[model samples]
Target: MSTVVVTGGTGTAGRAVVNALVAAHHDVVVTSRSTSSVHGRVRTVRLDYGSPADLEAAFHGPDAVVHCATSFTGVRGGETELGRRVLAGARRVGCGHVVSISIVGIDRIPLPYYRAKLATEKLVENSGVPWTILRATQFHELVTRLLSGLTRPPLVLVPDIPVQPVAAEEVGARLAALAAARPAGRVPDLGGPEITTLPALARSYVAAIGRRRRVRAVRLFGSVFAGYHAGHHLAPGDATGTITYQDHLDAWVRTRR
Candidate 1:
């Protein structure tokens, strides 16, 4: 079994990747800023991405590294610096393969987070390490989280744009599988089984939670929203995931009970 290290293994996608790796019987080690309760039999280490020493220590002796860590806001060039540090540490320890999880159509999206992801991708490509980049569309849980935050009592405001939401578990499984195999650079993008609108997703979320909120579609004025509306973030040719948005909602509602 190969030893694999997953950064940000406590977060949604990271946790799913860790679980899949453990189930595959690989020696898995997860790193985060702080210790948390992990589900499976795996090792957790404290890793501060800003500290090169800590990053190298965490990356030591790993056969492969699946990079799932990302800053949500991508402010102050933090994400780019983190990516550089990860590459540096991986190179210092002579890690074989570095698999990076990126977002779909990040190159087409002009948002701050998407820009940061693109920068990270460039870093991995030039890091001189054998690397594989798997770009996936937005996750279902992210859509639900966005909708939940916009639920203002009687009205649920949603952006008027299209999205293809994939399951984090599926993305994680794909990352794990890639980590085990030979490094293939820039694989096919993964997306949801169907293309859906934001308003429909919000309505489904409201119905799932049994809320009486009126889902309203609002036209957001921004380049980011324009890109989303233009379907730049979709993978029409690469809808590889099988989970539907309704399936995600059903599972989410069941968890709340």
Candidate 2:
């Protein structure tokens, strides 16, 4: 039986990947800083990506490894370091393929997190190990939250930006498929069915949830605005998602209602 190791099994995207891989009858092992809600046919391995020793042990003997961990609170070099450590461990253990999930528009976004993600991609490519770099758009849930606190005095000040967000579940399925196959350097970018602007998305979300709030689109006028207008944060035309934003939003509303 081929075994696949998931590095961020507790995250939104990683959990979905684990479930998809397990459903396909693959032996799956998950590694995280702490234990997750483990399911049947999934074994949890405790690992902190910064520590090479733990990474080496968890990565050893796996057929393929999927790296989905993100260092949110650490220093600027944290994500890059994690990627380096994971790749080093994978190569040492003779793992065949490594699939990494990355953000779209990371190179031109100029955000600290995006910069780290971009650096990590280069790290994986130069690691001398077979790898797949899957760049995906924002998740629907993330966009929803960004809109949550924007209402102020009957006006919603959402930054003007384009987005094609995909559901977390779809991304997970794609990652599992990538892990089970050979490295595809840079795969087609994945995004939602329709492109929606940030302000419009916020309005739609507010309306759907019966918030009775008026969403007022505002132009961004700073480094952040420059990134927003540059369209560096959106996926290109070649890659599109099967699920629509409306479908995701409706489902999300149902879950909360």
Candidate 3:
């Protein structure tokens, strides 16, 4: 069996990828700073990208590496550093393929986070390691988290951010498939079924949770503008996912209930 190493395996998308790989009969090794949050049949290792030694040790004997680890809230400098460390470790261990998860419209959105993601993509391409990059749209869980508390009080200030919500499960499946295939420069974008707005999403979430909160759509110009002006940071054309936002909401509600 081929061994697959997944970075950030404790996270939402990373965990899903680990699950998918294990279910497909692949040997999965998960690495992250914190292993307490991860649960499954796969092996777990303690890792910190800050330490190249730890990273090298994790990469040892892995057939492929799924690079889902990211520090999205920071500027580009730190991400660049971490990307370099990851590439070095991958090379040291002679990993066959590296599959990276990135965001759509990173070129169009000039935010620090997107800039870092774009730079990492370039770094991966130039690392001399065969690689496949997948740029996916926003996750429905991320959107729901952002809108969770917005429906409080008298008025809810909703930014006009355009978003095409994607199910994390679909993205996870695609990532696993990419890891199992030959390296492609960049894969097609993955997005949800329909285009949606921030306010509409907030209302749907409030209803889903059976909350009696009222959400008023108030237009605001914030960092969301940078994310919104590019059409909600969504990929163009029809890259429809099998799961819908409503479907995601129903699932989340069922779990909570």
Candidate 4:
């Protein structure tokens, strides 16, 4: 059993990664800046990203590191730099492998967040930490979250764009597998089981919650939307995920009830 550390292990993808590692019977440590109720079997540690010594200490003893910590909006001194810190810390402790999760179409999309992710990918490539990068499509939970942002009263406005959202757990499982093995550079892109319009996904989510809200598709403008509209963010060729969006909402609704 290897000691595997997951950064941002409380968030959606990070939490899923931590769970998979624990299920695999690996020694798991979660590093987070924030606190949340996590698995009892998993150990949580607070990391001072600002302190190099502390970061190096946090990096100690992990056989591998699965980097899921991220923020696209440049919050808290920019999420793009988190990769650099993680690399430095991992290198300091001589961690064998560092697996970083990234989004699909980051290279093609011009969104600020995508730009930041692309920059981080570059950092990981040159970090000299024996790294592996897995690019996956957006998560089903993220799609729901975005749709929630569009919710205005009784109507949920959704952009007219095609999306293929993979399950967070599936991506986490893949990352765990990668963490257990030697560094393999960039792997194949992972996407959802099927492609669907954003409005369709929103409608399903609204129905799952028993909400009487109408899901209306709106044509958004700008280069970001243009990229989405052109399906630059889609991975139709790699429908490697098995769980459907409906399956995701069904499980989520059960948790709420």
Clash count for candidate 4 is 0
Tens-digit lDDT string for candidate 3 (5-85)? 998887889988987898888888888787633345588888878787898888999889999888855554477667778
Tens digits of per-residue lDDT, candidate 2, 2-52, equal 789998887888988998998888888899787644567788987877787
Q: Candidate 4, which ten residues in sequence have the lowest lDDT sum?
A: 32-41
lDDT of 1 by residue, 1-257 (tens): 78899998888999999989998999888997887344456888887787888888888899899999887668465788778888999998899999999998789879888899999999999999999999999999999888888875687778889999999999999999999999999999999999989999988888888888998898988888788889999998999999998999999899889
Candidate 4 collision pairs: none
Question: What are the lDDT figures for the candidates, one per model?
Answer: 0.90, 0.83, 0.83, 0.86
Count clashing pairs, candidate 3: 1
The candidate scoring highest on TM-score is 1
Alpha carbon deviation, residue 172, candidate 4 (Å): 0.8
TM-scores, each model vs. reference: 0.95, 0.93, 0.92, 0.93
RMSD of each: 1.6, 1.9, 2.2, 2.1
Question: Which one wins on lDDT?
Answer: 1
By lDDT, rank the candidates, best first: 1, 4, 2, 3
Candidate 2 lDDT (Cα, whole model)? 0.83
Q: Write the per-residue lDDT of candidate 4 for residues 104-181, one digit (tens) a residue.
A: 988988877788889899989988889899999999899878876776578677788898988999999999999998
